[model samples]
Target: MDTILFYTPGTCALAAIVTLEWLGQPYRLCRVQKAERQSEPFLRINPRGQVPAMLVDGRPLLESNAILAHLVDRRPELALLPRHGTWERDIANQWLAYLASAFHAAFWPMLMPQRYTLENDCQATVRQAGEEAVRRELRRVDTYLEGKDFIQGTRPSALDAYLHAMSRWGNSLVDMAKDHPNLWRHQKTMARDPAVRFGTAVERGEPPPEPHALVGHVELASITL
Candidate 1:
């Protein structure tokens, strides 16, 4: 498959990138500079100007959760998800929806409080509200992982990668290490993964190490839309 992932560093795109690395499939990366994400070039790829968009065989796939689910469907042998039509599958879908919707929305005011309010003085309060929301959600996730190593149990799935990515933002907003031990453990363990490391290194503008499946990194100046 001709696959190319368009991402901005530190976004949820990291999860999909890590999953692709684990699949060991030949692919390429397109790093969209944050300042230029909403510009014409990226807007052409995803009208919403979102990160975590991809071109699979020249077809566009947008949204992080959709990308993760597609990866599972593409490589079912990995068993990253449970079987279809079962309660397990429904529960898994529920988690994905929650992460993408409520969990992710909670970070907006914290990350971009200006969007939430018109008054400059109100931004701080808006941000605080977002932090409170994030903390509450983090506690919920911690409780969910109380007895399991990952969201779906012991075997590492794409879900863990998703959690790891979102939790990176969550960790920055709160003292995850001190307050949410279970989430902290999950984050640290996933960070040790070579695939996760590769995604992180690339996000930092480093070339992936030798003998990797990554075709190469592309900048807007270097490639056509």
Candidate 2:
């Protein structure tokens, strides 16, 4: 079960890295540079040219949600996720879906306004709109966490890792404590975890020999689950 994860700084790929850490699985990390993500070599591996591309024994896997889910599936003993055929698991899946669709979508326009509009001047408007949407969505998440320490109640799941990474994108623009205390509290709790710190440090472009434990290894030629 050799796993290789390709990621860039501060992307949702942190979720996969964190999940692997939580599972205590021996895997490899490939820190793809921002400029090289869309390069031919990476594109050949993942046509989407996205970060967090995990190669399990040489079988390329894309999509952070699916990759995280697959990790949970492979290591049920870790209880990284809720039990199968249970409402708790369903709720966890819902959170993952929301992060994949709603939470992640809100950042696109703000990060890449040109993709939303053709007019140069309208880019600001698009960015502003995106920022507002991000705030609204984040607020909703905060409200949802009013009485819950994690997305699935008391336990920290991959959803927490995903939310922690995504929430960082908004930290510069919005103060979570002042605007979204519940979510802010959750993020603070998540930050204390070594796995979360390791994933985030790598995302922040931390070089080798840092304080973090998780690090990438040599890439494999080919293998599958």
Candidate 3:
């Protein structure tokens, strides 16, 4: 399979990278810069111009959850997800939906208050609301993780990768390792995986051109296809 993942550093796209690493697939990585993401060429690739866009055999796929699902679907033996129609699969979907919708939504106002309100005076209030929502959600998730080594029982699944990438976002709001012990424990466990480590380092600006890496910047004007 000819695969290429477009990503911005420190984004949820890291979850896709982690999935790819775990799949042990040979896929290319294309670093998408902020300015280039809005360009015409990138927009052609994904109208939304979002990161975590994967081109499978040059066919584009958007959304982090969808992309991760596609990867797992390709290799069911990897068991990143439970078998279809099972209660475990249903629970996994529930968690993924919550992360994609509620958990991710809580960070927008805190990170980009201007997008939520026009009144400069109310930006702080909006941001504070976002922080509280995030904290509450994190607490709930931590409670759910009370005795689990991984989000889905003991085995590391795609949910674990998503949490690994997303829990990092909370570190800016609280001492993740201290305030969110369970979540931090999950993060720490994923960190030990060689795939997670490599993906994290590269996303944090480590040297790339590793296996399956197609070294190139996302440039609109210069795009060949």
Candidate 4:
């Protein structure tokens, strides 16, 4: 398939990047700055101007979860997902929904406060609420990872890739390592995984951080959501 991934660093595009790397797929990566969302060219590609939009065989696919699911289906050999009739499949779906609807959606107001409210007072309130909600979701994820290596039992399924991408934002917003040790460990592991390192490095415009630097700092309160 001739694929072109329109992406921005530290955005949901990381999800599709990770999936592509895991499948060893060859594709083009088009960098789009978040601030350029209003540009005429980007607007034509995706009126929403959102990152992680993939053009597969000339057809555009928006939304990270949809792209990931499509990749898993197309490249079954990667086995990012599980077969039908298994508990693994159910759990994978659960995590995917939780990430998209619960965790990822919480960032909407914080990222676009003006869309949420016209009043500055209301905007701040909404943004703070979103931050707290995201913290709560992170706590839930930490609990889920207490005794498991990945989201769905032992293996790193599609859910783990999605969650890993979602959690990367924690570095800018909260101290995930301080709040959740298991989750922090999971992040480190995924960051070092060959596929993840390659894709993240490409997206970041530099090499992946050293493995030692993966230990997250405890200064979470310093973040302003």
Candidate 5:
């Protein structure tokens, strides 16, 4: 299989990268600079001009959740998703949609106000609303994680990967560690996971280092324009 992933640092691309690493799959990494995403060459890979687009056998795949599903389905041994007939599958689907539609979408306008409106007043209002929505979504996840180690059970699933990536945004925008204990613990746990560490290192343009304890480590870095 020839797989090439076009990714932007610290974006939703991290989830797909983590999932691919966990599956022990070998693939080429194509860095997509934020400023160049709109260029013709990058646009050819994904007309949407989005990162985390995967090219499998030269066929393009866009959207993080879709790429994640493809990866897990193609590598069943990784067990990122539950068995076909289980309730876990449904729960996994729920969280996938939640991450894609709810958590991830909530932050888009705030990150890129130009797409939403040209007016400063309208853009500010939209950005503020997006920020508030993000906070609310974090609380929802925190509550859901209260008594669970992972989203579905003891082991981390694809949902965990999705949530971990989206949660990183919260860590950057909001001080989740101070406000949400369960969510904070989840982020800490994910930071130590081998796949997560590798994915994050790749996102930050750093090499993977020896494993270390991550109890007090913060998962997200401040994002600047």
Candidate 6:
């Protein structure tokens, strides 16, 4: 196959998965179990031991943004992103960077609390701090999203897929409706999209109807790279 993706459950990988489906390009999904990320074979493909890794034509694209950017670039006529090098593209890149760096890191405490402290007693404190950090990031995005149908230009783009995935993570930690109405509304809007819903179901480990772009799923052992 020309394209294959390795993803862990509940990670931001959903964004890329949704993007691939949106492109309607033939691609395969390889859902990795959480423990498998640290395995020797998996590490060979991605030493950092994190997920949302894409293997396109036998080469690895390890970062989420890089994977998404490649997918978007493949089908520019769809305008999944604004035209490259434009002011709008810069703004879109800014949000993608913010989500990948600040927003994603804020969830590490909750997602991998053991890494935060050697002592188990400090876990709750670390998680509480994480919640606060997530709220801060949410506030920024929520504010920016005011009176906007999507995060970027008027149409739905890869930006919406990226935001929808991360914002769903934040919603799990806080009451988005009461604390972040705009964000809550954004979530509602994104969830209604077919691609978004398909991505959501797939990440949730459900048997979602496969999209035409989904070449099918592959086993990790079957993938050489």
- Poorly placed runs, candidate 4 (over 4 Å): 207-225
Worst 10 residues of 4 by lDDT: 216-225
**Candidate 5 residue-wise lDDT, 1-225, digit = tens:** 777777888888888878877777567677778877897777777888988888788788888888998889887766889866778777787778888998888888877777788887798888887888888888988998998888887888788888888787877777887888899999999999988988888778786654422112211111111
**Per-prediction TM-score to the true structure, in the order listed:** 0.95, 0.91, 0.91, 0.85, 0.89, 0.95
Which lDDT tens digits does candidate 6 get at residues 109-135? Answer: 876788989999999999888888888
- Provide the clashing-pair count of each candidate structure: 0, 2, 0, 0, 0, 0
lDDT head-to-head 2 vs 5, winner: 2
Model 2: how far residue 81 lies from native, Å = 1.2
After best superposition, candidate 6 residue 40: deviation in angstroms?
A: 1.5
For 158-219, candidate 4 gives per-residue lDDT tens digits of 67778888787776777777877888989998877776786688776875444322222122
Which residue pairs clash in candidate 1?
none
Between candidates 4 and 5, the TM-score winner: 5
Model 3, CA-based lDDT: 0.83
Clash pairs (backbone) in predicted model 4: none
lDDT scores in order: 0.86, 0.83, 0.83, 0.74, 0.79, 0.85
What is the C-alpha local distance difference test score of candidate 5? 0.79
Candidate with top lDDT is 1
Name the runs in model 2 displaced over 4 angstroms.
Answer: 205-215, 218-225
In terms of lDDT, model 6 sits at 0.85
Which of 5 and 6 is ahead in TM-score? 6
TM-score of 6: 0.95
